[model samples]
Target: MLPSVVLMSALAVGALGANTTYTYTFPAGFNIGLVKSDELSSWCQGQRNECPSICKGSTKQNTCEPSTLKFNCVCADGSVPDVSPYIQTVPFYVCEATYGQCIDAHPNDAEGQRACKAAATCGSKNASAEDTTMSSTTTAASTTLAMATSTSASQTTSSVAAASATTNAAALFGLEGYSTGLMAGAMFFAARLFL
Candidate 1:
């Protein structure tokens, strides 16, 4: 029984250590507007212009090109502006704004207009529901198991696993690297306790 518990704890810790990457793609109709060079540049420039104000002491330059539209304001220190608040509110303002411009520019193009409209509505959809659900499920299970074990070691291990699961889930939306060192430290401590 002790060996099984150790094995299970080790496996949980291993699972938490796995590196995962998440990519967020614009909704179907939104891509059409985003693909236009002029619109893309306009959006990119808007984000670039806001970088200095958003990410103080960061190099304010056009970091985004037509091919890659990364909207985050990356600082010289390799940190990015915390846009999580805006994400909760505006979601993809760049896509929405550019799509509006695309629709205006192609007034007579019905398909393009429809696509822009569809893109505009994407902000209302809960795209991260699946990721959130998965994270929550994992956290709940880990917590339950930890409570059942009724040991500080098990509880710590479970908390780390839950945190890792949550962080991995958040990574899908491009919010990463914030708690990496902290998680590693916690994992090391938990492992020591287990041993």
Candidate 2:
């Protein structure tokens, strides 16, 4: 019984260890499929220390002590680089590497604020700035996730609404057309929210 218990504990630890420090593969067409926030996160955790990257103003990796799936994106290349489906980067965030060491930014920085910001040991930026390149990269990645989620939700809602047009459309018609006016309004509102 004692041996069994020890074996169980060790097994559990191994699984946990794998998760704590693991790698995620961005396969050839990973960007094509649905956003793999989970996989990306794992990779980021191991790579630059950011994962499940975000799409705010800039991408950021969580640099907090005890990090979750956090990471910063390094510009794979210049030009209209595709972070992933629908997620295009006008400008890419190069890894937060100026000389050699990572930017030891303070908590005040917008990009520096994210505890999970990774891939950057820290940069020369003295933590007074607003955002970092990693911030942009992570933001772009996160935006991709958000857009994917939004698109999925929209598709689902549209599909359901299409069937319920007779009733919902009638009810909403009293206020505003659910499919046209209402949805359009909602979409605009969502755009603002994201923007």
Candidate 3:
């Protein structure tokens, strides 16, 4: 009877542990899909205190689960792996500013630069005084995303009304057309709110 009770307790604990959900909060404006896996690995290597090999291994290993789109640490036999060690959550503004900064610093990294610009587009330009580069990058990427979306006239107007008062024409439309430009602007505004 004692052995059976102990076995049941251990089984229950294991079952609960397997399904535990860990929520990792990413920056408000940053899109996980925009950045590639390799870029994340590279970022970890450069920014983390751990050895680059271990950082790279962490990324390569299935530590990052596809379901959550965030890394989870799973240790192999006799190995202790620190899962989710590389995530650095910053304010939306800082993340945008950093992306803009990275564009200049790492010119050769096209994917990283594009991902950074995409993130910046979803954030606000309120940090412009602190980092002009971020402002510029956000403007360019927002325009690109808007153009890719190519919002319709009615959609533009309704979206503009929904957008925050702080949103500006330049921030939304890339200054293309005073009337239709509002569409892109509103779309960007929406992205900031939701993404």
Candidate 4:
């Protein structure tokens, strides 16, 4: 019975530490209504192909269900991809791809062309705005750190230690999702023994 319990606990931890799925949605102002239902799957596939180019990882298991508006990418190795670059450019890429698709589907439809063009422009502007916002946030964080450094030595030291500890704890907990699973397993085993 003890061996079986231990095996279950280990299995639970393995399951918890498995692949993570990431969802990518069309940026705001993207007119999903403009895209035909049949075309969504193709668009998503294209986006999936674009993932490795944009993000810093492989995306072999990325998929998009037909008629769905989102793409799903699985992190097979339990390492979360750095999606900052992908996030910054996805809007523009999505818009451009939609526009290209629209053109391919209806070359002579002036109204469709205009709509697609407008959406593409909106996406471009959105990407630019996102870049600016991220820059501002980074600047603000740097300024805050500089300010903290100017505080009294003891207070600064304490604050830095607390911040470092919190960051380390969070990182450990987040890594491979193992810490959470281990804690839960330990609790389960303890409860079983008590019972």
Candidate 5:
């Protein structure tokens, strides 16, 4: 008697998902699908971390994990209530991917704004007038510093290039190999490697 009731519940949940285990059946020959919704819930909850990373967000469908025996849709409260096939119409603010059907919708709108706000995001500066002016000054200062750094780097590079050219000229002069420790090292390495 208890088993039959459990099977009935599975059937009911399976109706919502063509591939969902929420609604199921007790076909005489085989039991291809036998899931207790409550049990499924626990199983799904355990696999929550592995759900699609794309589902991360405030307006997220935080229901059963993708690992459910059969759950392709999320409930409003973030539950995987797979009464889908049995459900003829959609409730407000839900992405219609239940009942073996998949439909993506903005979890945002007039009614959804409250939820969105609760899921706050770090946004651009909503500064006061004085703060805005201060920010502009900081930005200007940063630009100036960047420019100064660029100029300093260019100057250093040019000086280094010029010094390198001078050293190359000394090298070409026949006394070229005498100026630095590198010359001695190169000669040693060359003799060792070649010989």
Candidate 6:
């Protein structure tokens, strides 16, 4: 009688779909195809470091990783409630990637700004500005220092390049000798076996 009651309760829960797992599968080549497809657009376009803002209401329920390359968005519980209705049929990966790119490009938070500015792409805009902007007084004082150091800097660069070239040549020769020794040993063994 107890087993019958437990079986009936299990059936009731299954009928309600309470514990059902939902998965969203993307079509093959969707990620690569997204490069050419302009149909789906991110809401955070032109906004830097704003990927996390997309999860305002569900901040605790979802994870947002903003990157200079792309923004990633996913449910913390790994259960994504169908956002298809809101996304104009865009795949979740596309949405996240787009958001991450925009967020990484336009960081608003201090840490994000530091990271974005440090990135190679953003460095030109952020670091180059500082490099190009020299105060007139400081530039005047450094003029003599630059003249004194230019020769040494050139010599240092030349020596470093020569060292790098020598290291590469030595590595190549070592690898070639190792390969030749192995082949010679294999051929000698084969000759003895056949004889």
Top model number, lDDT = 4
What tens digits encode model 2's per-residue C-alpha lDDT throughout 1-90?
111000011112332352122122222111212324554344333333221222222322222111232222322221111232211110
Error of 4 at 45 (Å): 2.1
The local lDDT score (0 to 100) that residue 24 gets in candidate 4 is: 48
- lDDT-wise, the better of 3 and 6 is 3
TM-score of 6: 0.26
Off by over 4 Å in 4: 1-25, 52-60, 82-93, 97-195
| C-alpha lDDT score of every prediction, in listed order | 0.51, 0.36, 0.44, 0.54, 0.39, 0.41
The backbone clash count of each candidate, in order, is 0, 41, 4, 0, 15, 5
Query: Which stretches in model 5 have alpha-carbon errors above 4 Å?
Result: 1-127, 175-195
Model 1 CA deviation exceeding 4 Å by range: 1-24, 33-35, 60-62, 84-93, 97-195
Better of 4 and 5 by lDDT: 4
How well does each candidate superpose onto the true structure, as a TM-score?
A: 0.31, 0.20, 0.23, 0.32, 0.25, 0.26
Per-residue lDDT for 13-99 in model 4, tens only?
Answer: 355664344434554444565667666666555556555544334643454444544444434443334332443233334556656
Using TM-score, give the best candidate's number: 4
Evaluation by lDDT, superior candidate among 3 and 5? 3
Error of 5 at 45 (Å): 43
Model 2, stretches more than 4 Å misplaced? 1-131, 166-195
**TM-score attained by model 5:** 0.25
Full-model lDDT, candidate 1: 0.51
Give lDDT: candidate 3, residue 84.
Answer: 30
Q: For residues 1-195, could you state the per-residue lDDT of candidate 6 as single tens digits? A: 111100011112333555433333433222333343333233223222222233322322322222211223333332334432233223333444444554555666777655433431210122222333544557877986897698789889899999999999999999999999999999999999999
| Candidate 2 clash figure, as a count | 41
